[model samples]
Target: MEPKAHHVVIGFFTLVAVAAALVFALWLEKSQTDTEWAYYRINFDHPVGGLAEGNAVLYSGVNVGTVEDLTLAPENPAHVRVLVRVDQNIPIRANTKAGLVLANITGSMSVQFTGGSPDSPVLNGSRENPPVIEAQPSTLTSLLSNSETLLTKADQLLGSANELLSEDNLENIARILENTRAASESLLQSREDLIALLEQFNAAGARTEDAASRVSGAANHAREVLGKLEPVIAGLADSVNSLQPTLERLDRLTADNEKALDTGLQGVGELGPALRELRNTLRTLNSFTRRLEQDTRGTLLGEETMKEYRE
Candidate 1:
């Protein structure tokens, strides 16, 4: 009987020690979770793929706290609200940004805080309304969104390519290629003619160049001749200018003697008739003198000699 009582006592003490240890552990865990902690809310506009309660909250790559709860935003179903607890000593500023980051290869996620300036005011809120840390789309979310858009565009491109390579279009392309080949063959056959045409064009261009050179030389020669004649033309102009006064004086003299010159011309015409009448009067006087000489000679000779002469 005494041995059984001793065993009961030992069992009781052992049970008490285990209960005390359990209570101490519970208190330690509670103290660790609740002491010097602050609460905050983060609103994410994109879907949080693998984030859940009890995930770590990191501040600039250091683990500071853990997420407590998650719910859809009351005002908009598209947004999600996440409640978190962090160390109260952390200087969560107004400009601090929050985002979800990948934790491991299993795609586990955690909330991360970044970008707080020293001078920014502390983020503050009441117990009922915790300060909201601005949330950004996770890298995975952005990559997925971009991939979806790229796939859609690729599908459209493929559809267009299919239409472009249809049977009718391919047939048209073949016909164009056949026509181009025929044209190329025709050009190859006419190579000599094309070369001859090119040669003729080159000859014509050379002749045109020679003609242009000759014309330029002729123009220069004409300019030189005109330049040489400039002085001769100037001398002639000077001579004409020097004779201008003489020509004017001759004009004035002719004007002044116009009446006297007319009277002298009239007198010369009247002198012609006076000279003819004087000649006729001199002829009559000479005839009378010759008759008187003949009579005198006959009287001086004897009357008998004159009679004999008459017989």
Candidate 2:
């Protein structure tokens, strides 16, 4: 009885273990079925940087699926094509862009998805017609490349520095320094003469400026005198024009008087003496007027300033 009881306990424990394994398997299958898969292609212009098959595909840091295949494009060997399996529940829209991201500096790479809008249409793809997702340059890859370029430049600079620090180059530099010192000494020796020449030039410039200023002042004064004479000349011309009627009257009077005198002289001899006296007075008056005009220079337009200059 004791042996039969032990066998029954052993058999019960074995059955329980099998039931637990079956339940775990069924749960795993249900979990896998909840996620649906879709296909897509990612085209990269840069190197994938150690990304290989079975690499994770993520959407906003969530693992969605994995890389199904990778290949270099047949038409353009420089381009890389990647086929990825993604969760169908995740909307792979037309506006979605892709990039290769390095999770760590150890070159572990993954595909990153961004910018999928709900209003966008689905990015449907198949084995023959694989929809391409655009990939940007990876930051890590760019950094690595820049670092390599910087190192190369640094190496070149070090080589040049080493060459420049050699014995022959140092001797050449020393010669150049000595020549510069000699030139400086020569310049110092001629410094006094240079200063004197500059001082003389400055003095000449100052004298020239002063002369030009004096000339300018003289020109201004002349211009002012001309301006003042302009009105005087105009008034004198007007005075001469005003004398036209008087001259005409005087000519008529002279013609009449000459005729009358000629007639009277024939009749009376005493009339000749009186006529001569009148002629003498007229000549004296004409002479006095001509002298006055010639002396005053026709400037006495009004009597207000006449006494000031005429006196």
Candidate 3:
């Protein structure tokens, strides 16, 4: 009977120890730290991965707080409300961003605070509102949603490309490549011709330089000749100046001769009429002389002289 009693006592103490341990754990979970802390709420439109009460809240990767509660937001049923207890001396500014971050690959998540502007006013429960940030989709979710369509399109494209690379088509492509190679060779040959042309241009430039030098020398010779001729030209100019008065006198003499020629022409015109009158007078005299001669001849001969006197 005493053994049964001892066994009962042992069982009772064991149960009491377990109960005390559970109570101590509950107290540890519910108790606040000695440091003063304040509560702020962050709202998100989706589940914040595995974030729950007692999850660590970090500011710039340093743990500064803990999540106090998580519940669906009353005002926006689609969103969730997360209550965080942060240290009162943390100096959280209004511009601080709270983001849900995956803590590890096991799908656990936490709320992280970063990039608080120092000039911004400190946030309080009454004045603070949750900032809506851009949401990022998980890699697994994105891949699951679009992988089939992407793979299907990729497969079709690959099949089409394979069909395009068939042997006859490949031969045609080879021919095209060969033609391109020939064109490239032709271009290279043309480049050689271009180099020769540049060489010719250089030679022509040398010739032009030589011609320019010859032209410059000829111009200098012409200048020297012109310099030598300058005095001769001046002397010729002086001679022309000296002959000017003589030329003027000759001009006056020529005018006087022209006037004399005009008077001579008039005299000749008058003499022509006088000569014509003299010719008529001569003709008449000649006729008279011939008659006188004939009469004399008849008288001198003594024939018909008595008849002539009776007449």
Candidate 4:
């Protein structure tokens, strides 16, 4: 029994559709895996809590790849070596850091990448041997890991506080507080005296400031006087300098004429009495000349002259 033309057409179309669907599925698989991956190694010295293989890797909060494997480092058993596959598009730089992050409060964690500078070169590696990326400890991981230690310390602190706040210590503290209260009350009562003292201090400060201002003014006046006197002082210095040559000449003359000056002084001293005698003789000569002149006049004047002369 041969199929009808319409049925045959439908069957052929169905086969073609199935084949197309298969091809699409294969292509989708290929396309999904077509993204190039870069492998990197991270060594964590701390426990990777809730971190597992197949966990999503995020780059700056965007899912970029997945964690491939996790194992204990063969060389150092204390370190956990984590192998991650990141998208080649995401620049896993030389300075890239890897750390585990909590996805939710349920404690599910995933590998995350952070701190890749733009200037850094892209980190390269293969499946056989991947480049090592530094592992950063996350805040949550550190808190969780140190929870015990923190609790222990907190317990010790509480114990110490309890011991310090014992009955005797509490009594001492109460006494100190009472004393402080009394001091406060006393200070409150002496408020007026304190205010008076503060006013006195203020007045003293004002007086001191005024004195300082006067001193500064005096200093300025002194500077001005000194400035004005500078030229006068300079002129006096020049005068003294000019007198140096004259003084030197005088000194030389006095030294050269020492004996002559002594003789001249002695002669002048001896001439004093002689000079007095000469003066007296000149006076007498003047008086004689006058008398002689009067006699001559009387002779020439005859009787009237003789009568005046007799009188």
Best by lDDT: 4
- lDDT by residue for model 1 (1-311), tens: 99999999999999999999999999989988677777899999987877899999999889998999999988998899999988888878999999998878887889999988999998765447799876988667787658889899999999999999999999999999999999999999999999999999999999999999999999999999999999999999999999999999999998999998899999999988887887777777676556546665544553322444554
Candidate 4 — worst ten consecutive residues by lDDT sum? Answer: 302-311
Displacement of residue 241 (Cα, Å) in model 3 is 39
Candidate maximizing TM-score: 4
* TM-score against truth, every candidate: 0.46, 0.46, 0.40, 0.60
Model 4 TM-score, all chains together: 0.60
Ranking by lDDT: 4, 1, 2, 3
Q: Runs in model 1 with CA error above 4 Å?
A: 1-35, 60-62, 102-108, 124-129, 138-153, 177-311
Question: Per-residue alpha-carbon lDDT of model 2 for 1-311, expressed as tens digits?
Answer: 99999999999999999999999999988986886778898888777767889989999888998888999999988889999988878888999888878866677899989888889998876666778778877677677658888899999999999999999999999999999999999989999999999999999999999999999999999999999999999999999999999999999998879978788879797778899999999999898688667665543443333455655
lDDT of 3 by residue, 225-282 (tens): 9999999999999999999999999999988799788999999889988999999999
Worst 10 residues of 3 by lDDT: 126-135
Q: Model 3: runs farther than 4 Å from truth?
A: 1-32, 50-53, 74-78, 105-107, 117-119, 126-176, 187-194, 201-311
lDDT of each structure? Answer: 0.88, 0.87, 0.79, 0.89
lDDT of 4 by residue, 1-311 (tens): 35688898999999999999999999977975998888988889999979889888898789988889999988888789989898887788888888888887888788888887899998888888899976989898899999999999999999999999999999999999999999999999999999999999999999999999999999999999999999999999999999999999999999999999999999999999999999999999888678668786654555344344553
- Which portions of model 4 show Cα errors greater than 4 Å? 1-36, 115-129, 138-144, 240-311
